[model samples]
Target chain A: MQFGPHLLLAILEGLVTASILSLTAMGLSLVFGVMRVVNVAHGEAYMLGAVLAWWVTGLIAGHPAAGFVIAAIAAPLIMGALAVASDRLVLKRLNYDPDRTIVATIGLLYIAQQTTLMSFGPDARPVEPPFNQRIALPWLERTEEGWAWFYPWGLSITSYKLFVIAAAALILVAIWLIITRTRAGLLMRATQQDSETAQAFGIPVGTVYSVVFGIGAALAALGAVLVVPIQQAHYLMGGEPLLLSFIVVIIGGLGSLPGTVIAALLIGLSDGIISVFFSPTLAKIIATLLVAMVLVFRPRGLLGKAPA
Target chain B: MLEATGLRAAYGPVEVLHDVSLTARAGEITCLLGRNGAGKSSTLKAILGLLPPSRGTVTLDGAALHALPAHEIPKRGIGYVPQGRRLFRELTVAETIEVGLMTRGEGRETRDWVLDLFPRLRERLGQQAGTLSGGEQQMLATARALCLRPKVLLLDEPTEGLQPSMIDLIRDVTVRMRDEGYAILLVEQRMDAILDLADRAVFLETGRSVETVARADLTPQTLHRRLGV
Candidate 1:
């Protein structure tokens, strides 16, 4: 069987896609798990991150890579502040009622989307890829047999895709370590498990929620910056990923880190394979159906326990 | 070492505690006895600053506690084991204790001390707190509160659903803390245990202090009449 270069490229794209999805979904999961508020505006926050990255990159005199670094660092700080302000001004007053919170976040999301559309315009903006040169994997190359063979025999991959995979893996590990190994992590886990108990233990539950929201916002911003090279910056770019991230979170289980990563990868692979055999619209429909089925059978998600 | 004077609190317009006055001296166990909703939990919460008093004062060693937040209260040498043994259910017993110590910024020394006090906890340190039996959870809650090395420990309903043996273990621990010069304010339903362990007792009825008696002065008939038992 001959595995063409195009198919290999698709697989590589799937990995990168999964990486971006994981980053965005992790934040959504944390906020939902700990706060029990379905922040419909999370997507808008991601869009805001991309906008900040675009604006910051324009200001800094550096390569596209440096631009990404600047955007990644700055966007989260800005978005986090916004999230905290939103919580205090609006969501906090609602007393964390889930239905009310969802409605309020939806309103905020539309406001955010409109603000970006009005300011940045509808056209897609170009963003320079951080690196200019493409690196080839010499170990996996085309042979007399074809592109499909043992890694030592006949397969090839791009260095850019590998970088994306490596970055995502590093982030996943770092998040795991921070949650399990550090004091802040323990507090976060405690808050997630039971806010009332955590508060009684001399933990400032409000501060923990604010900081978690900040970190969650920052992660989404980081994902936007990372995705700039592949998808370019645009006002509407956040919508697709936002929907995909929700699917990822639901599939991964409402707050499990390991589940989020696995779900992201599955979504990425399925999308890639389906897009190869079918249209993007059909692939999306299939993805939605898959999520609905999974939810119907195991509402808690793949790794999630039933909510207490 | 802990005192509340003229403390008044309300949930909305309905007051739960009114002009509540009490004291827990160092080297003594002061137990509060009341029927359900008699403001036993509310008094503990008011002292810890969990519920801001509409009027009155809470002082720890003569330091004003009203202005400070709940988390800050623990730092000032007051440990609280709230109602329902509010242990972090998902965390292991060791982790639950460790979190209490985190606020103090002290290391393993505090944890080791708590474990020594509750040696059974040492055996179940790695077990999830929620998986522990009611008695074990109560022990874990007390151990977690003590991890802060507070001068005063506040316990609410500490022996609600424990076997008699576990209740005895908890009473022994309270007595030991009192001997070690730590002040304790305990709220409990087990009248016999309270009578045995407490140096003095305060009774509340409908959010008002109805009686304050020496532990030796309490009799079954007196308790029955006063508490409507």
Candidate 2:
């Protein structure tokens, strides 16, 4: 393919990656931002979403859209419940001590992985897309008569992929509204700012933490549900997303939602483009190098506040 | 009335408050005075259940508070302003007050009354608490607590770092709360503030209540002997 068409395809692929990455990374960032807990099991929650999506859709019949819709709704809610249970049963008991929570979540990661392996098995399973009509894209070119448009070979995107991008954008906006405009969001921000003070003011910080954990896991699950059609569900699939999300969260600035989204775009786009031009391994290496540069130059992160 | 008796609390294995007791009655300002590390703040913490007491009973109007969680104590009509102001730095002044009122399910009337008390806060309602001047932040913290309309208010060094004018404003507000028939427990290091505002004083030394005296009995010699200032 020519450079122009190839570049366009790469950008389209990058948007899909970015869309999914933002949701996954935002979940991790929200958990860290509000609860001050690095949820190492976040990626497992994502895998559970994909696996559950497969199960839920398999349970249903008729139109693919009906199964897809049910799977999307049920998977996240289940993931959220699991997350809340872990938060209450595990993280809360640790008193949310930073070091202790990390260790606890690492334990949770293994437990989730092993449990999923036992129940769902180790096979990678694909979920059918609700609608996947491929639309050929047009390219601009100078002809003998004048400038014209033509269908470029292998330059197209699936309708489902576009839907993923649009859906992610809408979800991000909805999350932004919840954080900035609602009373629950106000309570969350209050707890994030000063939990002791929030508790003193009767904000029920523990309950808030539970709810935040549930929401964070739900978000990651939602992303997984969306991506399961393109990728396959497997117990081990969480490892890559976890590593990529950690990188995005660190580069974007810890716990900053906008920073998370922006960093996801940067990393995701670079990953997609570089994979097309060079190799996926080289893209990951470049991303790691970027994180190192960010750590050395901007340790607080792209948008993280300086320590008070 | 709010009373804490035989209070004992520890951080880790080290007891910081030992057998400290005090009473804060309605329509009066009860001050806790001592040198640093003398368990004044710890006494307040025990009362609020922030540091659960090993041996103590806190009663607010005959209801036991020590058995309750720290967050529950506030919902039972007690407000606290911790040392260092502890404001939600990112929240607007209006939002800070709203958070305080949320537990009590208060409405615009309580918010308006708090705003009326600190009119300067009303002017900066949309400003972030962290960006406010030190004096303004103190006012907002007190204002946020007041929005709860609690029967009891616990303030720990509310005037720790403020200008003379701001100090006077806080003192005036504290006095007004007293006159409004609220039970107030105050922790302070400033002798002038105690002299100006305290109806009764409890002095502490090394985690023990050394003495309890009336404002009139708090002479300079007594203050010098008890506070070591």
Badly placed stretches (over 4 Å) of model 1 are: A1-8, A132-158, B12-14
| Candidate 1 pairs with clashing backbones | A140-A155
User: lDDT by residue for model 1 over B113-164, one digit each (tens)?
Assistant: 8888888899998899989989989999999888888899999988888899
Candidate No. with top DockQ: 2
lDDT of 2 at B156: 97
Query: Candidate 1: deviation at residue B164, Å?
Result: 2.4
What C-alpha lDDT, on a 0 to 100 scale, does residue A271 get in candidate 2?
A: 92
Query: Which lDDT tens digits does candidate 1 get at residues A161-221?
Result: 6777888789888998999888889999899898766766778877887778777877887
Query: For all the predictions, what are the DockQ values?
Result: 0.62, 0.83
Evaluate all candidate structures by whole-model CA lDDT and list the values in order: 0.83, 0.92
- Residue-wise lDDT of candidate 2 within B77-164, one digit each (tens)? 8999899999898899888988988978889999989889888988898999999999999999898888789999999999898999
DockQ of 2: 0.83
Query: Which 10-residue window of candidate 1 chain A scores lowest in summed lDDT?
Result: A148-157
